[model samples]
Target: MPASLTIQLVNQSTSENVYAYITGLAIQHGMARVFLKADGTSLYFPGPPPAGKILQPLTENCAIPLGPPGNTVTATIPQMAGGRIWFSVDDKLTFLRNPGGPGGGAALVEPSVLNPSDPNADVDFAFCEFTLNNDQLFANISYVDFVPRLPIALTLQTHGGAVQHVSGMPPDGLDKPQTVLRINTQSAHGTLKGTVPAASPNQLVIGGEAFARPTTADILGCNSGPFATGGGGGASAVRNAIIPRLAAAFQRGCVAAADVSEHPSHPETFYRAGGPANHYARIVHECNLDGKGYAFAYDDVQPDGGEDQSGKVNAGDPRVLVVAVGGGGAPVRITSTFTFGNTSMIKLAEVA
Candidate 1:
């Protein structure tokens, strides 16, 4: 049986947010081509903004060229069978495959053609072109494998620097962790400086049981849930172990987070003001450490709200606090402090 493939526009800021596009038939084996009409269409997918909106294609046929500066655009493509496939945008190129079922997969390509390239290539596996915008542009191809059931891995190459691996684990050796892999440029040439230049990294070996040495998940497990009950810190623990390995390998900051909750509107339950159950809050602050700085707290309670039955002095409802501090040396420290009811959890460790 041939593989089933479907391609739809995943992101576009110019159209109504709807999945009214096309649900192409299952892709069977060989190469199945799907075209996107850039003449005004929007594609939707699961998740939040930037990561969700799968943009429509600019052309109804194969091959599209995005003139000068490559801008932001998103599109979604579904794969049925498990195998290797390649993708290219403008002059940038990469490959993807489905190793365990369907979902996100790893990227395989060199660093040179990861982004929009100057001198574009004609014969690409999949082609797309769009204008460059102030917003960050992204494109991805996923592989699905049913045999051993594993998470999809994405391998990305940024400019002429180094290949940085970013994806949830089950791909890299860890078991089901969300982590962000950051790669800063060590050296560059011409206009590639500062920006994540176009290049494709190599293929990622997933689910081989070989313990590929330094492995990390994008988001840790602990603080990822909603209720303030059992196992809220497991994710952070895994992140602490992986950060040092990646930082030493790439020589830059590789930040990762897990179960850490966002701020809350209501202090008592830490729920969003008018948001849904999963709504998150944000708080930013700067701390001046005196070399012997031990501990500090940020007041979360509001003044207007009166005290409860405890009479312990009412301030405001306190929930979760994500702290980010810079300026130390060697192993930098970024911690998350969560206060639920009378209980508190503090995580002070290296970047994941």
Candidate 2:
């Protein structure tokens, strides 16, 4: 009779061995094991091992010592892969077989080409490449296993996480609209894994887990939704592209027209206008590209002694009031007083 077991990795990868015979070496506690690699290589404890350890191997074709024959014990030769009996060596067996762990301790194998001694590669074991230690293979560096998968047949299948379909001629001047997408899990492990397909503006990837850190741009996108924040009064850019008028409306001034007290050098303001006072001012109709209805600060008259005790006359801020926007019902007003650099200019010129 023979015994067998399977080794599965933490990342959900698997490999199986139907026959594994106990090493005849006198290992302490009967813990030493010898199994054959997928490539027909062998791993086993060499020499007079510590006494007590016993592990059974499955072999349908090999002869075993049914009864203890003399002091020189003989272990069974498991099913062969490369026409050679397999054996285990040190440095290649660092894993502890916890028969108590989930999956019945059969879920894992130690010192495996799939699992490197250094845990640093735990994140990439599923897709990295490593070569197996054959009978002729000598030491140095660990191995990363990568099994190959078969070609997937193309067909019509709808899936979630759908990327937006892009359309247009790419810089390469090629217009390619990708309609058919093949989604599948990585069949093998190693340097080769997921693919992005040919480079095309419309080439869209479908599935598989791609390990990547998320960026702020990916998480907090522009306010494209209804619950997004409104934009105005910033050194940056306008938040909304749909309502330029609405954004400008929230902007100070440009409400109604008022007395100009007009001077060529001084910027014009609707004395009763609502925006902050500044040295410069301009009115943008936005709707007109002709630069129509544009106005700016040309000159100004600072108050006598700069400050008036009346506070009502703070050397600036002309009492001459006027309408900012005319003919559109209630006008929006703004102060026409010109300060040295307090210009809160608004842009209606962007209105199209």
Candidate 3:
């Protein structure tokens, strides 16, 4: 793989104030927290804030303006992991630096939807996750959080004349999901539980382990109840193995007799009516043009030869990645004429 990858950010939205921010751990630089400087090629590493301080503002501007609609801004980035390309419309996102605890390092505090008091609460925004390393470039559109008004589409062009495209939602698709999700949630509450005889109305018995029924919020967030890991820790082995089958079962609305834990290997079996289903997830997938994209935490889990519902595109020969925002647009084609250089600082006053 090349030392760095080129990403073309296209502002296809009607808003003129669309800004893109890149943040992740730089693999080449000792895994330091790196943010692309406003120049789009240079990198910004925030220093540690004062001890005991919280929500400290960044020392430099990291928002890369994409200009007006039909415009594209090219950015270069080194190999990184746990990376995200964040987009906001008509407003700049507030990113804070949090001091590290004992034996830990400082961390970047991105925008949060669950916190009502968050600085970027009122902004319309969305993000996509990625990891580019020596092996390959893996990227995907994530909906693990609440969906934003700004829909994102991705196009990855490999060097060997291959193209992969993921068309996100259309401009008028937001209202459709809202209406369908509300109806689904209301139906789930009034319906009966699963048909498994060994399972209770509120519990599922998988391999002798009992999983409590998840609340409506738990089903949507995929972060609490049966989906939760220990407080702030990684998921356990058992949880990881059970969640996908369990979730697939809920969406399919039945269990297999031989392996009560066995879930359907096909995507067509999920989210059927007349059974309890994650309507939120079902609605999100339906809203996408390709019926692909991450609707839940374990959405990537699929049986051998099964279709990928997680909406990911990756290749070891990635030539360019095109991220088009604002939903509706012709697919972006990869261009080879783009070049990259060092980042020159842009004063906050000039842009703010």
Candidate 4:
């Protein structure tokens, strides 16, 4: 767990994909995706502060910004001849720095902000994902949470579009690509925690081929339905959603729903401590990730038709999520908007 988790890395791919690199449990504790290029240059996704925000569902494409010259970053993999003891990331990612801090709560300093002038000490953020070859994707550590090591699980679902592998590495095509992640997560950890296919609880051993395939009910969009909402008429109504699919597998046609309750008297849970807007409200989404208790609150302000605080939540505006989660344990909120172009696909990340 060195400050950088520095290791002798290697990429076995002939063609470089954006996600092809070793990720680390970064100083921030979030998953950071690191990409090492054939040329000694690298690009880390979900870049650092200011330039990049932490990786969340729907918002995982941000890469560290390059300077005017752009080639400021440099990276290369090692060449081990005899049976390369490949150095990749491990599950119990304990990232420690030069000072050597405590377990999870602590982190390596993320740099004194991104200053192009002071390029001598630039910190490369990691922890999201890495795409070495178009065929595969591995997690790049971002931020880590130090607490009771309860099993972590996530459910991601999208509308219409299903998973289509470009290189076709995963033998037969999977109806639900997200559930296929069980094989990946199990590969990382021994016990079967995720949406494992059939075969009793922890029956499947750690190694070897994936135990089973999802039943017809396990297909991606097969068990999904249109989004459900409570308020906002056409405006407050949900134009679309990035529904959570964890519960969709066996819930029998319940594709997750969003409940928008506008309160002029923003309650404690709905209230955003200190934000740009003087007012606040809540947008409830049942992601089924960790049940209703861990559901995120999409913080937002109502519509008044003004430049900054203007929305037609009751009419034609759509409320979109700006910051997915409002700190931990707080209910998710939503921003009210009238523009049809505002609401787009929901961002749902099915974490391992």
- Identify the leading candidate in terms of lDDT: 3
Ten contiguous residues minimizing lDDT sum, candidate 2: 148-157
Position 305, candidate 1: lDDT: 48
Locate the minimum summed-lDDT window of 10 residues in model 4.
80-89
Give per-residue lDDT, candidate 3, residue 28: 91
A best-first ranking of the candidates according to their TM-score comes to 3, 1, 4, 2
TM-score of 3: 0.52
Winner on TM-score between 2 and 4 is 4
Give the better candidate number (1 or 3) by TM-score: 3
Q: Using alpha carbons, what is the TM-score of model 1?
A: 0.19
> Per-residue lDDT for 75 in model 1?
42
- Tens digits of lDDT, candidate 1, 175-291: 223232222222231111111112512212111111122212221211222101233653233333222222222111111223312111123332223321211121111132222
lDDT of 3 by residue, 1-352 (tens): 9979999999989988999999988889888888999999999888778887888999999999999999999999999989999999999999988886222445778899888799998898999999999999999998788666689999999999899999987874342211110011112222122332343655654444456866556665666787665524565455555665555554444333222333534676676654456777788898997888887766776655678888888999975555567875324443335334663322111111
The candidate that wins on TM-score is 3
Please list the residue runs of candidate 2 whose C-alpha ends up more than 4 Å from where it truly belongs after superposition.
1-29, 35-38, 46-123, 126-211, 214-352
Reference-based lDDT, each prediction: 0.26, 0.24, 0.72, 0.26
Off by over 4 Å in 3: 101-105, 177-352
The count of backbone overlaps in candidate 1 is 66
Worst 10 residues of 1 by lDDT: 189-198
What's every prediction's RMSD, in angstroms? 22.2, 26.5, 25.2, 24.2
TM-score of each model, paired residue for residue: 0.19, 0.16, 0.52, 0.18
